[model samples]
Target: SIDRKVGSQLMPDTSPGVSRSSQLDSETHPHVDDTPSSNEHHRPTPLPAQLQGRATNKTFQSMTYVPGLTPKIAGILQSKVPEGTVITSTMSRSPPPPNERSSVVYRLGCKGCEAKYIGATVQKTEKRFSKHRSDVRNGILATALSRHTLSSTGNHEFDFEDFDIIGTEKVRKKLMLLEAALIKQERNRINIQEEFAAIDNCYNNLLLNLNNH
Candidate 1:
């Protein structure tokens, strides 16, 4: 028994056992973790050098369109305005079909003459202007303005700068009343000679009735 004990201490155990050095190595140098660190994930992306000081928040503003100066104006605006500011054009363009939910009252005037035309539209004022132009071009003579343009001016030409939007209203009756009020206020300026009295009388009666109600 004494000899067996001495031999057992001298010979290392080899029955499916790991070496001491390998076990110590595994504890010291563990497998690398493939997951990324939290700091790396939270890092922000860098902006371009030119855009470093510019703001990212946006603001929009309306501007009138000038035929030849619009492009130059836009370029100047882009350079002067902050990086995120947006500019919008207020000039009327071809709008879609009529929408009765919103109504607009507007006026159109001759650039050199005092002749003005008061009008209302259920759709956008742009669409209404397009219709007026179409009627004038076709010689429809449907409105007093069309008649005046055909009789006075040999050609159908008007100044775009003279166009103005008076007001907007959702209610049809209120819109009509507003239109009548504008027409009455600008009565002397309009060019409808024979039809003026009739239109004025009609609007006056409507106003009187509405007031009574």
Candidate 2:
């Protein structure tokens, strides 16, 4: 009988025939993620921080979007004059009567333009003219005139042939009315213009940045 011993028993194959990679289920395979990770939650983002701190100035560039003057704004208009009654004590028992005159002077100043007008006012000088400035700045030129005559006092007193001494209040009203009329008559003659619209647009953009923030 021939000796028939195998040189070494072949090791029994323990591994499956399929590769380890192929053993993994397709659904369980690791996915390549492009999204931000949870660790990045605290990272400095590009959006909110980028848009902050814009439009923080109050210069001409910041005044855009100021609403145009409407009747509602007029109601809010305030007088520059202090509200009170004036009392004067005179040497004589009978107090001297108040002086009334025609033609008040209005000093209207803009960024570069300055206008002088002689008109009448029934109120204090400073208070009445403030309205003129407001109206002029708002493009309501019907309130600023070239020649306004009102009840003058002290150094401001001046006489006009057509005008008479009305009470201060009457003078104020007359001055305002005359100024308004002159502004209307010369509305075409007066070369009035403004850049508020443009300024407002720029400011509006600034405000938008604030809103977005």
Candidate 3:
């Protein structure tokens, strides 16, 4: 009977005892969603398609600072590599102990000759000096000072007492820059033999390349 009555009027039942008032309320004002609308301002904006692809495809690289060669090497890598293909970053050498941190630049004067070798190190001055002496005795031709000592003198032993701390810096870059400056200044004075000129030339080339950058 109720379905027939509502069908005749083509409207929902509003009779007493049939939840009529609630039905009428629902019809007049539909249920409002209690869940809040998403705030566009707080939502994270996605990266652009190109950038997204680049980020996925890009290769990350970490290069250690090589005293004089780092800047030029970094520049070369940036210039030669595709813009989004490779990401290059420079990392400094590992930090030394607190005692060694205060000793940055050092100079080693030859006992026989006036020639001096300027160097920078993050390690303690005494430790570095010991290593240099060891390297010289071991005939390590890789270092200019060691090569000079072996080639220029009859004896391979370096004077441990001849070395002195020239300056100190907290930053390795400042110490390296100071070392480079000192090397440049003392380049002409150092008696690097003709055979060991290549070692010095390679170092000088690095300095030149660094300056060019």
Candidate 4:
């Protein structure tokens, strides 16, 4: 009887379809992965922490969008605060000065007598008052107030501190009419002859009757 003993199982048999040498080659060197390598150049860098959001300049009208910024690049550039834009903001102007107001009815009081003068001006009140001051001082102008001041008055100045505003009107004739009516309202006044003639004697009689009551 021959004992057919196998010598240490003679290197296990390979599949019928594949050879043993090919299986050994596959186990030693595996398949290559197609993923990127860490050493790969030309890779996109991430944005810096300050510039991470979309607005590097967005949504804010005050900001300017800056591209190509990165933490590493900023550090190399020695970053500092950028200068701000200069805006020429302006405010609306205010109204003219009080004494510079126009279309006004004003009164002037005499320093020596109970004489009052009611007048109106299309120009500024200060301009009219300045002319009146110049008139009494120089005696050049022949305006009604100046005539009275030059001829009848003992005072030098027109008592500008006593200058007062009585009313305001824009229409020329109507403003003069207001001055006329105001002159009538006052008991004592220095007015031009024409203004005095325009008043109704009946109105004076009515005022006299009312005051008597």
Per-candidate RMSD, Å: 13.6, 21.0, 9.2, 24.4
Candidate 2 all-Cα RMSD: 21.0
Estimate candidate 3's alpha-carbon lDDT, on a 0 to 1 scale: 0.61
What TM-score against the true fold does each predicted structure earn?
0.42, 0.20, 0.40, 0.46
Candidate 2: regions farther than 4 A off: 1-115, 144-213
Expressed as tens digits, the lDDT of each residue in 110-134 for candidate 3 is 7776677776778777777778778
- State the lDDT of candidate 1 residue by residue for 148-169, as single tens digits: 7777855435554456666555
lDDT over C-alpha atoms for residue 212 of model 2: 43
Candidates 3 and 4, the one with greater lDDT:
4
How high is the CA lDDT of each candidate model? 0.62, 0.35, 0.61, 0.63
- Output the worst ten-in-a-row residue range by lDDT, candidate 3: 191-200
Which TM-score value belongs to model 1?
A: 0.42
lDDT of 1 at 182: 56
lDDT of 2 by residue, 94-212 (tens): 42222222243222322222323334455555455556545544656363241121222223212222222222223444445434333322212222322111222444443344334
Off by over 4 Å in 4: 1-98, 196-213
Ranking by TM-score: 4, 1, 3, 2
Comparing 2 with 4 on TM-score, the higher-scoring candidate is 4
